[model samples]
Structures are given as C-alpha cells and as structure tokens.
Target chain A: MELLNRAISGTMESSDIMVEIIPWDKDLEINLKSDVKEQYGKQIIALVKAILDENGVKKACINLKDKGALDFVISARVKTALYRAARRSQ
Target chain B: MFDNFSKKYIYSQNTRGRKTTSDFLKTLGLSFDENVNITINILDGKRIIATASAEKNLIKCIGVDENYRSKGLMNTLISEIISHQYDNNIYDLSIITKIENEKVIQSLGFETICETENIILMENNKNKFKKYLENISKNKVANEQSSAIVMNLNPITKGHMYLIEKASKESEQVYIFIVSEDKSKVPFETRVKLAKESTKFLKNVKIIEGGDYIISSKTFPTYFSKNVDEWINNYCNLDLKLFGKYIAKELNIRKRYVGKEPYCELTSFYNKKMKEILPLYNIQVTEIERLEKNQKAISASLVRKLAEEGNISQIKELVPEATYKYYISKED
Candidate 1:
C-alpha cells in the first residue's frame, strides 16, 4: 500500500503511541521518540517494521512519539496510522 | 539516584490520572494551561518530581519537587524541553520565570531581555535575532513606506502569488517573509523554493526567511494542534504581539498585508487579531480578498487535497506555473 496523504493516529497519553505517517518517495524511514527508549526501543522498532512490511508499505515516513506503550499498543497504532495514510478504515 | 528519574512527554488528556502533576505545579505557585504544546515530566517511580511546559515560544510553569531542589533535576528537565523544541526547528525560545528562578534559567543559556519586579522575560538566540535584523537592514530595499506579508506558502499556489503581487503593487517594496517552521507536509525548503520561483518576476518583492520569529512553532503551535479555538486565540495573540513589538519596528514596516480568509476559522480569527493589535504599534493592516477560481477560493489546502487524490490536472489549475512544473518534475 502507498501513503496517499499525511495521516496521524494515536495520542501522546501514557501506554499509548502517537504515530504520524507521511508520503515519502524513498525507503521506509521511522523516527521514534520514546520514554522507554532505554528499555524496549529495539523491540518497538522491530514491531513497527514488521507491521509495515506485512502491509507491503514501501516508501513512507513514520514518526512515533511513544509514552511507554506495550508491543500490542505499538503494533495497533502503526496499523491504524498506515490505514489512515492509505485512506482505508481497515 | 538519577537512574530512577525518567522524563516523558505528557498529554493534556491524561490529567485525570495525574492530579499530582497539577498539584505539584500549584505548590510552586505556577499555573498550567491546557494549551501547552509540550509538557515534560521527570518521574521518580511514578511520582512527578519536576515538570516543564512550553506553549509556542514561551516556556513557563516550571516546577520542581521541593525535595528534589538543587539536585540538577530542573536543569535536566529544561535541557530535554529545549532539545525537543530544537528538533522541531524552533531555535529561538523565550521563558517568563519568577524572580527567584531567573538565575537558574539564565544559567541555561537564556539572556534576560526584560525584567520586572515579579518576573523576568528571557530568551535564547537573542544575538542571533539581532544579527538577523542587521542583515535584513543591510539588504532592505524597502523604505518607511514598505509593507510586509508573512506567509507559510505550504506549497505556493496562485492564491499566495496573487497576494504577493497585490502587496507589491501597493507598497514601494514588499517584504515577503516565508514562515520557516517546518509544520507543513510540504517541507520548508520546497515551500521556499516554490515561493521564490513563482514570485521571481516581482522585482519589488524581497523574499526573506521568517526564521523562528513569526508564526513559528514556538509562537503558533496551536496552528498545528487539534482544533482548540481558545489556544489558537492565545498563541496568535502572542505571536502577533511579538511581531508588533520587534519585527515591525526593526524592518520599519508601516503596513502588514494578509489575505482575507473566509474558510479557516483560525486564520480568520488571526486576521481579526491582527486588525486589533497592529494599530497599537502604529502599523496599518490591510486584508486583500482571496483570489477565486470557478467561483471558489484558490487555496493551497485545496491544491494539496487535489495532489493527494492524484488529480494532477486539477492541481495544475490551482497552483502557479512554476509550482505545477516543480510537481511534474518531481513525478518524473
């Protein structure tokens, strides 16, 4: 799926992740700002990357501002952000 | 001791579970507004030990737990907030601190520009702004009869070009300050490029970067935030005041030009505020009616929507020739 426009999902609340996806022409670029970066940063990035790969998203810029969200919350936020970027509800 | 301390950005909606955050700020005789663009809280095992809030250009309501005083927690929290602002491309930051906490913030690279008995207003990059003014003065072709127009030009459309063209015709010289904040989907570089390319024919138009001074994330974060009418009013007032006090005087701008916005409520409100505020600084405000196409307003947002829908032909109609060419080149 290709991003059609700039779409933002989620909130900055604790246990939540705010994800913003913008259309990019090059490779997938992810920038993460997390409170729990010292602990589970790598795992969170891997989860987001896996979700994007599963959706077949090739060129997009993803910005996530995390407030100690769990893996499931991170995955759900990424999926919703991508869906919104692609202008699809699912 | 520092290992247990972690700083995190807190959302305003989470206030329900974080009563202590407000209570902590209140204990220090500071009030927190709901319009804060970013709030960083230093936590010690789930207890808020220190907090800092930034609204547009002003950083205020800094409170540290009494027990954590002089432990370098305030400095650390402020550093984090400053770093966050810089990442968002806001280099110039201002803070209004109480007389007691003035030295602490001053030590963190904020110079006291104005001081009252109760509060001190300090800002970073004070010398940089002065240098910017000096540079503009040196290259300024505009005399006292000059007018200024500050625009985002998210993707310079015919509407923006029309406004610039009108301003140039009316004033001896028009200073076109492109909003430097990178809040738009169109990057600042591309926006500036399109504005310059589209307006290259206007010899009386002086294109300059607005830098972090005008309509910046520091001064107008409400423009990017969710629809909060009150926040928009508050931040817009602050930004316009800064323009009236500093920008207008330095550039000798006698008039400010703006497009009449009939669509966005926030922009209309800002225009109304400009009408109210600029007069106090002896500057007149002129609003030109927006250009139209097919009986509708020609706006950059509309052009962006067309581009998003991949309606390149429709975008070509809304934007200037230079902008259309640039987008077409990008597609290749």
Candidate 2:
C-alpha cells in the first residue's frame, strides 16, 4: 500500500514539460486514471505513448489524478507518478 | 510431393509435441505451453520448412543449416511454397531471421528492417501497402504555436480519449504520433486508423504517423525481452534524439502533450527519463492523471482482453462512447 503526493507545476512552452514526482509510500502499487476535456483523444493517447515509449513499459500498475492539467502540467504529473513508481527503495 | 509443396499442411488439432506460438511469443518474452498443429512445407525433402499456423495472417519463420548454402535448395523450398500461399491471399507474411542473413532474403525480394542488432525484420515487398503519416512535429508546418501529442496505443481505449481531448484544449494545434511496429497485438495501421476516426472531428488536431525510427521494433527493440536494460537505454536515446527536442524543433512547435500511464512500470520509468531529457531540448513534460474505471486505471490491454472475450459491454465504461463504438464496429 502506497500513496503518491506530487506537485507537477509548470507552464507550457517549447514542446517541453517538466514534473516532480513525490511518493508517500514508495512501495504502493500504482494504477492509472485519466480524464481529458472532450475532443482531445488522440493527443492524450500520443502523450501517454510517448512516455511509455521512453520508459519501455509494457505493463505496470499506475494511478493518474487529472485536474484538466495543461500539457505541461499533464507532463509533470505523469513524470511524478513514474518517478515514484520507478524509485529504488531508499 | 512437389505438387503438394505450396499447399499448407495443418497437422490436425491437438497434435502431440507441436508448438504454435513458442517462437514468436519467445521473442516478446511471453510463454505458453500448449499443443498447436504445425504448418510445414515439404519440398521433396530437399529442404525442411516451418510457418506460423494462423488462418487470416501467416507468419513464417525459416531456418537452414550452414552446410546447405548455395545449393538453391532453400530457394526452391520457399519460392515454391510462399508464392502459392501469397496467391491464395495469405497476404500478411513476415519472415524472422538473423540480422546477418539478410543476403539470402534480399535476393528473394525481401527488404530487411532491423528488429534488433542481431535480428532482421524481413518482409516481402511484392504487395506491402505503405502508408506514410508525417511526424507533424518534424514538418515545417509554419506554425510556432502548434503542439504535438504522441502515443503507443498498444491497444486504444477510452481513457486515452479523455487525455487527448484535454491536451487539445491547451494547444492551438495538436499532432498525434502513432507507433508503427508489427510487434503490438493490434496492428499499427489499425491503431492509427482508430486514432484518426476517434478524433476526426477535432478541427485543429492532425493525425501524423510517428515513423518507426522513434518507437518501432526497429527503433526501441522489445524492452520486455531478455535485454530489457539495453532496450531501455535505446528507448531513452531514441526519444531524446529523435522525438524530444529534434522533432519539437522541426515543426517550430514549442508545446507537446502526453498522458499518464501508471499501470505499466516501463511507462512510469519513461515519464521519469523524459523529464531528465526534456531540459536539453527546452521541452516541457506533462503527466496527466490516468482515467479510472471503478477506481482502476483504464488500459488498452484490458479493453483488448475484454474485446477478445466478446465482452464488449465492459469496455464502454473504460473508453469514450465514440471510441467504444468504433472498437465494437471494427472488431465485430
């Protein structure tokens, strides 16, 4: 059981987005959750695929909490969750 | 025997000691122990041959020993068999062989795409339908405010719809990058078409083909395989070099959007790695919360499983209404 407390704050520019992933329990299993404003299906999927392609993840448990985050913020939260999930136990 | 050479021989159901998916599945690190009838081509005993026993799509794996070179034996065996099968509409054929053995295949009209450093991706060029979708990010679109969205869509699902829609709102323009590799369960073309059809109404959204250079088997190698670490590094480099800053620079688009996938460990790692790499190119990274269904992260794999089992009803809850309808229509 684990929880991720993360703040991915950023502004969108230059096709680049940054995120900070902080986890309350490093061992918590992850699940993925998402909700986008209507009409952006392809873009969202592409973004997810890009991140997955970078990480080489075929499958894992992840959770996504979305707040209508812009691309930059969206990128941030995703990076944060991934960072926590992939963090080596300290 | 020669008259029956080109004919496909299915060795009956429950054939003892035969394997169906072992070879192809092994390449992906998936395992299954079951009896599957083997498909063989017997060319008058001059050469022994094997093929994947699938009805709609046929995947052929060919192997010959060292001593049998230059005898024309292999040629006679494959040419006689595959030509007949191709004529009969077993159109999707793939031959997997060692990377170094491309010479033999090249003479047979096969083009090799590198599956790995040591593995070759060979396909018959006779009637391969090629569809080109530009990396909009790489194109000189003349718009500095445009943004791009990239996806693997291993299997497209509804939550994916939500994320894309959200990203579209923040950008004046959006480009969708689809991973083009045959290794996925859903064919790349099928996934691309799905993405296109699902988002066809978005006025500013453009569907672009993410070339195999960045995320295909030829580029990323199967990270799920034995060489996971090596594949991981390959993926990072490919993203940083090809997809990250370079592509962003190409379209003169400064903003890029991505979705959240916490269900997959590899994806999670990718989000982290991209964050480190984005700064070099002045790209920003966004990680949207993954959509949930009954408190579970939505996944394309889950949708595929349910679809395969004919449980289309369950998928609607996980995907958008339009996407679910699209999936059901195409699948049914």
Q: Best TM-score goes to which candidate? A: 1
Chain A in model 1: its TM-score? 0.95
Per DockQ, the best of the predicted structures is: 1
The TM-score, computed over Cα atoms with residue i paired to residue i, of candidate 1 is 0.61
**Any idea how many clashes model 1 has?**
2
A56-83 in candidate 2: lDDT tens per residue?
Answer: 5544433333324466656655655565
Candidate 1 regions with alpha-carbon error over 4 angstroms: A1-90, B1-40, B52-73, B79-109, B112-121, B216-219, B223-231
Candidate 2 segments exceeding 4 Å error: A1-90, B1-141, B216-219, B223-227, B330-332
Compose the digit string of candidate 2's lDDT tens values, residues B37-108.
234433334333323332223234333334444554444445544434543545334454556778766554
Q: How close to the true structure is residue B101 of candidate 1, measured as C-alpha lDDT?
A: 78
| Cα RMSD, each candidate | 15.0, 25.3
- Residue B123, candidate 1: how far off, in angstroms? 2.0
Across B169-239, the per-residue lDDT of candidate 1 in tens digits comes to: 88898888888876687898888888888888988888888875676423343322233555555566667
